[model samples]
Target: METLKLKKLSFSARLFTRAVAALSVMIFMAACGNKGGDSAPPNTLLGITNCATCATSIPSATAIDVFSAKNATGLAQFANMQLIVSATMFTPGASSAYNLYTGPVAVQGQFIAGTTLVDPAATYGYGNSCTIPAGTYVMQSSTVGQMSLGMLQLPELISTTGVVIRMRVDQGMLYKDATTQQTRMYGSVYITSVNGVPCSSSFSDVFN
Candidate 1:
């Protein structure tokens, strides 16, 4: 009789252990499902540029698309997320290769210029600007003049019909000089659509 009782107890314990294990697995699966569902929210498609590989942070006024995203809970998640800048220009054709930045001009702000002070032993030039147009532009490099080693493309300027224009600088890349061997500097420009479209006017006037 004692033997039978011991056998029954052992069986019950084994069954209880199996049940606990099953329950644990179910809980784990539920947690995993919740985690998988929680992905970074989708962001609006913005222009991509290579960041200036320098010490200074690109100013915010040069940013293009500036917006925030929220989760289903209505909580703000990513704010002012900028586009990733590419190190090299986007080559569509063989002759389409262009420098990312040219000598800067006063598009919205002051007329900043591109610099040629690069680190020796590097092959590319550095010092880019953080200004771009709203429309898409083809990247090109200028073979003439002082500004000769960055990306260049003219964008179609539009009128900002009473909307707040925001800028966000994200990334940059710097080239090194072949002789001096110093790291060059680069910056990005992200232009985004405002209330209607971005114009050459001030942000306040854009909303007016």
Candidate 2:
């Protein structure tokens, strides 16, 4: 008889799970606050919460590089698939490869959506030699709204309109504002496109 092996979770995935656990604790604490006080629910991973208004400024590094060292191997998976991440409700910038969103995004969309197609090799100007494969990959997420395998529609995703994009669920992290204690999700995804084109892809964003 052949034995089946179970894959161990990646380091990033472990961290993501820990972050979610922390968020759950925060939510419970927020709910138990004094009734007379203005107790707003702590932000969940599902969506934004006054992100634009948050006092913390966006980091200078790309979203993928913001939290920790950039995961080159993880990044390659997204590129091989010709997918890019987008900032929530905002258009990706055209000057760079991967065009990962770095700003706060509003509700709706993948917290970001890719609006164009750039060469997969140009991501971060690393001269990636990976080729874009056929088929679709949905943006990877563990949130309730993102759990479904259905095709997500975002008119802004010109190249990836009909295609599905995949992102590593472990690459994402939940960000909590030190001042406001509000939490948000920031993670990586694949991207390919610049200035808009016909090829399909999806982009991931790192929200602060």
Candidate 3:
């Protein structure tokens, strides 16, 4: 009887130990430190067309630290080492070719969609791998040619005049993320103005 009792106690101890270990693993996997909600928000709408080097989607809240979301922190280095971005808008029927712009951008603070009423579809895009900082970042298009304007002849169109052939992020992450960085949000890149004249440019298939 004594031997049987000892065995039963030992088995219970082992079972408890295993349960504790499993709980610890679960905690680590979630890794949602103080960052707000229980999990990331639904803003996964992203389409990247011109990566040129990297071919992986952005890390998920579960895979990487959601807290990593910040302003254009390390964008310059990211643009140089990470991916290049391209954003395009279609022109009217039979009149204009695809209005395309490309560049590498950085921002501080991670951006979540719907958080800001400004852009809800996450139509905007960005590129690069460094931490984002709070400020503006510019990406220049290496290729810009007009099918009609005799190519290169009208440099001003794509030049500094209105800053065409470029993608710019004026303080990415329009809305600030929770200090905890727990909630995931969506974002999009739409041109606010063009040709020295502020114009709302609609965008499609924006790649970051």
Candidate 4:
């Protein structure tokens, strides 16, 4: 009877020790697996241009704001990244056009080019612009063309003299995980009129 009792006591002690060890391992892994949200680097700016036909050169004194958004499951929500530009323009409105390119931007606070992870669908037009999640992205123009004169309305006129033109660009970032993938829309590059002068601005969607 004494021998049997000793064996039972030893078995219980070992079981308890194993349980404690397993719990400790689980806690350590949980800490290691944690990852905070993505972040952007410093000194980033959103660029714009004014190429209206007869509008005065975009005042070098003008200022513009840039913002970012993210979409985790559904739509875009406002993000922390923001960019500003003091002035942007180009010589010979017809020849060069007022060009504004945002400052060098990066994600993960590292400022690396082409390092931003993006969804393949967002870049190819298969995904919606309002559904991108939080991540770093690169912006570039994809197409430029003239709009039909008939499409211009007095209220919609960007310039009274300059021909109405349009430029479409692919803008956003993509991210992928081991089991899932997501794409988020940051903003769109669209032509707008600044004081009835043709110009461009980038706007972001609000993620919810």
> Candidate 2 lDDT, tens digit per residue, 74-156?
22222211121233423433212112233321122231222232343245344432233333332322221211111121212
* Residues 1-208 of candidate 3: C-alpha lDDT, one tens digit per residue: 0000111112257545643453343244234333233333224322223222212222220111121222222221112111122222222232111112112221122222211111111223322211112233333222321211101111111122222322232211111123332322211233333333332233211112
lDDT of 1 by residue, 1-208 (tens): 0000101012257545643453444334333332222212225432222223211222221322122222222211223232222223222222111222333311111111122111111212222221222222222111111122322222322222222333322222222222232222222233333333432221110000
TM-score of each: 0.16, 0.27, 0.19, 0.20
Q: Which candidate tops TM-score?
A: 2
In order of TM-score, best first, we have: 2, 4, 3, 1
* Regions of candidate 3 where Cα sits further than 4 Å from its true position: 1-32, 35-45, 56-165, 169-208
Deviation of model 3 at 160, angstroms = 21
Q: Where does candidate 2 have its weakest 10-residue lDDT segment?
A: 146-155
Which runs of model 4 end up more than 4 angstroms from their true locations? 1-57, 61-66, 72-135, 140-208
lDDT for every model?
A: 0.24, 0.29, 0.23, 0.25
Question: On residues 1-208, what C-alpha lDDT tens digit does candidate 4 reach at each position?
Answer: 0000111112257545643453444334333432432222245432333223212322342222222333333322333333222244322221101112322211111111122223233344543321222333333111121111101111111211223222232223222121211111222223332223333132221121
